[model samples]
Target: MDMIAHNDSLQLYASDLYHYPSLKQPLAGLKSTKINLLFGHDEPNKKGVEDWTFSSDHRIFHEKKIPYIYFGVEDHKDYHKSTDTFQNINKSFYIDAVRLIIEAIKAYDSYLPIDSKD
Candidate 1:
């Protein structure tokens, strides 16, 4: 988290190999963007496989209370396999997922350097 802030990042949104078709869950930090609402809400499933708490990088942010979000999709047949090639990706879903992240960044940029009272 500090490293991201040191590098001048407004917020961090980590996108894995796949993203959900309609839901982009915010795994940690401030839920201050419309993307947070569009993707439902900031829900951290500490014990779940997709849980950001389990990710070493994300865990640092979570522990430090820094802003972060995680985007991912349910496991597919090709997950973690040789068959998981670029050509097998869901292009449309991936595109939308990227767009959503862009939108989130744009929205947050306008109100960045967030001042937290915590």
Candidate 2:
């Protein structure tokens, strides 16, 4: 979700930018490469396409009829059950997922401009 927020900001700036967890930290420079939209929910009962096109910056990204990647993980009894514990989490997979998002942000940040506007 944080990555999504940063991407939203990128849509406005359209230039190199980094969003740190804390304002006190230095921002890492980014290079905008491609738009990677992760659509889908982890919950079994919640699955659908997320439409960012209705957003104000809809015109920023090119539209296409092709399909996009959707993070569809199979839901189990522990999907959202209270029994879901950190010990049961897949650490490696989670780390890789986060790394991918970071890489995408870093790549896209380079071409973003702070003064970009509608």
Candidate 3:
């Protein structure tokens, strides 16, 4: 499950973020947060993980044992291609996703030092 904040300021975003019909969206399948931190480099974590960390910026931090949160949609038809332009982005969905990330950060901040197992 997601660990986003449940406060008043973030409450209004529930509809667009959580209630949105992601199942019907081409960029659906919000990946699990914890699983990524655990199995990021392990053969592209597919089972319960949200998405693979193929070539993400998180690799360095993960290698350093610093846990990080990833908020991203699944690959689209234009992923990593020249056609992956801003014009192709669904603005409304992008905005909602950012909002959800903000809320999640607020919630995650409460936990602070998300330490490593070692």
Candidate 4:
């Protein structure tokens, strides 16, 4: 109960501080789901995007041609070692990353068919 309350409080604070629009679907709904395989762009220097090392059920996904879009930055010197703060974030680069993902999703959804084999 205390954890739930804390999470709710944090969610409320995030919404208030950032004007975060409430998502209709819960996070639980996204787990184990195949997201659309939208186009991805990495910077020329390969700053934000890199090969994901975590093991995934990709072979199964690929056998069925499941699509997914991965976004976010690579682990660098500033990653989670007390140096990765809001101030260190690149604003323009972040914006471009977001825009590219948004466009990719739009284009992918428009062109691709929903996977009927579950």
Best by lDDT: 1
C-alpha RMSD (angstroms) for model 4: 14.8
Clashes of 1: 0
Q: Please, what are the lDDT tens digits per residue for candidate 4 over residues 1-118?
A: 1101111111211011011122211221222212322222322334664333222333344346443433433334555456566566554444444444455456555555688996
Distance from true location, Cα of 62 in model 2, Å? 18
- Residue 111 of model 2: what lDDT? 37
Q: Who wins the TM-score comparison?
A: 3
Model 4 is weakest, by summed lDDT over 10 consecutive residues, at 8-17
- Predicted structure 2, TM vs. truth: 0.36
Angstrom error of the Cα, residue 92, model 2: value is 0.7
Could you tell which candidate, 1 or 4, scores higher by TM-score? Answer: 1
For all predicted structures, in order, the TM-scores are: 0.50, 0.36, 0.52, 0.42
Collision count for each candidate, in order = 0, 17, 1, 0
| Per-residue lDDT of candidate 2, residues 1-118 (tens digit) | 2222222112212211111122111223333233333332322333482333323333233244222222223344555566566666555544544555566455445534567575
The whole-model lDDT of each prediction reads 0.43, 0.35, 0.40, 0.34
Between prediction 1 and prediction 3, which has the larger TM-score? Answer: 3
lDDT of 3 at 107: 56
In model 3, what is the error at residue 6, expressed in angstroms?
25
